[model samples]
Target chain A: MKMKYYSEAHEWIMIKDNEATIGISEYAAEELGDITYVELPIEEDDVTVGDTIGVIESVKAASDVYSPIGGTVTEVNAELEDNPGLINESAEKEGWICKLANIDVAEIGDMMTPDAYVKYLKSLD
Target chain B: MSDLEIKNTPLAECHKLAGAKMVDFSGWNMPVQYSDGILAEHKHTREKVGLFDICHMGEFRISGKAALEALDTIFARPVFNQRVGLCRYNFLLNKAGKVMDDLIVYRLAEEDFFIVVNAGTRAADSEMIQSQLPEDVVFEDVSDLTAKLDLQGPLAADILAKAGLKIADLPNYFNWTEAVINDIPVLLSRTGYTGELGFELYFDADKAADMWNYLLSFDGIKPIGLGARDTLRLECGYALYGHELTEDYTPLDAGYAPMLKLDDFPEREFTGKAALKALPVENKLIAITLEGRRAARAGADVLDASGTKIGIVTSGAFAPSLGAAIAMAYIESGKSLDIGDEVQLSAGRSTITGKISDLPFYKEGTVRKKL
Candidate 1:
């Protein structure tokens, strides 16, 4: 089963075996309003925990996407180049920003689980 | 304004019920966008119709026999020639020839006029005008008692008909007429910030919710928030109050030389007339369009090809209508830049390449459509 983890910064990472897919959480997507442009990380680029992997510009403001766990960027979502609204439609699935490989699986233990993330979101209110 | 607490419009409850996301705008809690988002709301206004709650804007009624000559001597525009039922966009300049506010003057009758000013500059505008006007003239700030709504789009007329509102004669462009909507008296103007066929309606604040709900109940009309309002105005190259018109810059810098009527009415006298005549034109406002959706927002440094700063962006946005980013910047006067000239703007951690375009980035607006 794929294990989903969420960071305090509102990024979500879905891990299956040793590979993980990362994207912004639905809450973050809604807060940003409409996504206009995104600058993604390059494939084969190594990123550390809390490193800004990309930049997302919305209609209202610009935000940086940070990696919660260290890994190598195996692939970037090419579909977002023309249609960034996919992030607003389905931020967790088809809107996944990037794929990570060669990651330290133990680093994700500090992140929140799906249920824990739900409880954490409630606390924000 | 008496307390530190933020103020809410009379239609606040209605906006919340419509799933609006609220934001603090000039000390008032206003909707930034509804559930449809800015892009969708923007396109809807362009294609269909959108309703905007603009009650936070300030309204002042100036009357008396001396009002006409007094106003003619107050604003940059030649108000003496402004006919009744006509609306004129004018500038309120400080003694230093800088813009205190950009307002609209509506001549209700001979010696009777209504002035609409920006919400943020309401208090200052009131103080300035009150200080300048003769004591015999009557000046009353009726902002609290008034609620303003803008019904904008190509289909705005159809929506007005659908709502069962009647006008003896539809006001011409930049003209206003008194009408009744849902048994409430209103002053309807055929004008808007968006480059679309629209109307601005002013009515009693007590009936704000009723008017908002009654108009939005129509099929084609949807409630648009301030987010789409900003993009819509920017796309049409309209100068926003705080962004494009500020105390730091003179009206001449914002490209209102003709309104000054320095040559047309050389003998005309106003508060800043002498300073405006003496002040050298230092900057010129130019429109720039980017290649993509990344916006070079206000305060971004505009640079030349060699990376030397030449100007600063005043207002910008990712225009939903054009599907690209556009900006208005004030470059140094006599830069010798022509249309289609390439330039650069500074963004976060990078520089965006742009080109000098015409005044309006979007051209197919229906604002001047004939009835």
Candidate 2:
């Protein structure tokens, strides 16, 4: 009933019963070094695929986080407001940025599998 | 520049082996951060000890009968009165009163001197200094053969003693001595970019990797990359070459007018003296503390209370030691702003608010501590 996929932009989306949680991939987080701030997307905002949902600020530079699947943001991780280092600690597991409801499952099929994403990271180097 | 054109220091292979994340810094293949990350490295340097690879910096030797008088005419600071074993922060300026480079001048002897400059401006600095010197002065670039390393923190002295250097024999602040560390002859200087009590060692290029591993072998010392180095210097309100001290601005704009000694020594004349006397300072460099962890990076606009742009940020970062964000900006001299004045910085999609503070957002540095 749960599935995970990764986008070419290095974002990960976990879908379960029409609701999806999103976060950046481990490779992306490692590249960011020490994350200082996370401008979380607002709840109740409608987002489309490939839209810039939020921003991630690291000690080095600022990076835009894009939405992988279109839906309405139902919840945001408020813990990141005070402790943004969570993303650097465990980007994929405990650092989920937001949860979106009514996501189109068809868009999830276009994402790469876990094994494929690992291969994709290899090709980057 | 292309990847093939990027130069490497002597310790590049050692850094790669230590899992450092390398980046291209000023055309040099340098390590920006190690596996422990920038924030951790910064904290470690403040609380413990850290080592840095600084071989890319340029050093020059100028010795002759007129070397002292020749240098006194070239720099904005007085060089003739400088005593042997003392180092002074000096500046080179163009005729139009623009800063060419900020360097350290060491009075090695009455006629012999050592100059250390930034890596990016080495060629230009050499050309400018060589052309201005007298025919009798001998100028030589000794950068390629020199390996530089900085052991910085409160425990730096203790670590040096552990490595076979006598703590009592170490030079005082802003002084240099020819000492032996672990049977290696080095020119050890009691100064560092970080506002910490530290020593910078200069030796043969072949001893880079060995010295790096030797110093870091201590329990208190860790290998820190340039990422933390930038943050540490910024927090201390030190002016970086390309950032706070650029060719587009003069020393007055960077709040270094007092160091120029224009009024203190009326008889002294140096390059750009007339231009500096004629030029009126248009900007005042100020420090600001951000409201939160977000940084106001360089090139970001600083706004007054009514949303009018008043200044531009030159350097910024979330200072790990302070637990808040800090930045240095040059505001219009015409603007009447005081310390603790509220200002806004436009960063990304957010307009973050901050308050103007004094230089050195982080205090309690051990740099001036008597050994």
Which residue pairs clash within candidate 2? none
A27-119 per-residue lDDT for model 1 (tens digits): 999999999988788999999999999888888888999998899999999899889899999999888999999999999877999899999
List DockQ for all candidates: 0.82, 0.83
Specify the CAPRI tier of model 1: high
C-alpha lDDT (0 to 100) for residue B295 of candidate 2: 90
lDDT of 2 by residue, B1-371 (tens): 56359899999999999899999887788999999999999999999999999999999999999999999999989998899999999998998888899999999999999999999999899999999999999999999999999989999999988988788899999999998876789999999988999989999999889889888788978999999999999989999999888888889999888787689899998898888899898888899999998898999999999999999999988888888889999899889888999999999877899999987888989998888
lDDT tens digits, residues B13-117, model 1?
998899999999999999999999999999999999999999999999999999999999888888999999999999888898899999999999998999999
Q: Return the DockQ of model 2.
A: 0.83
Q: Write down the TM-score for model 1.
A: 0.97
TM-score of each: 0.97, 0.98
Candidate 1 residue pairs that clash? none
Give the docking tier of candidate 2: high
TM-score for the first chain of model 1?
0.97
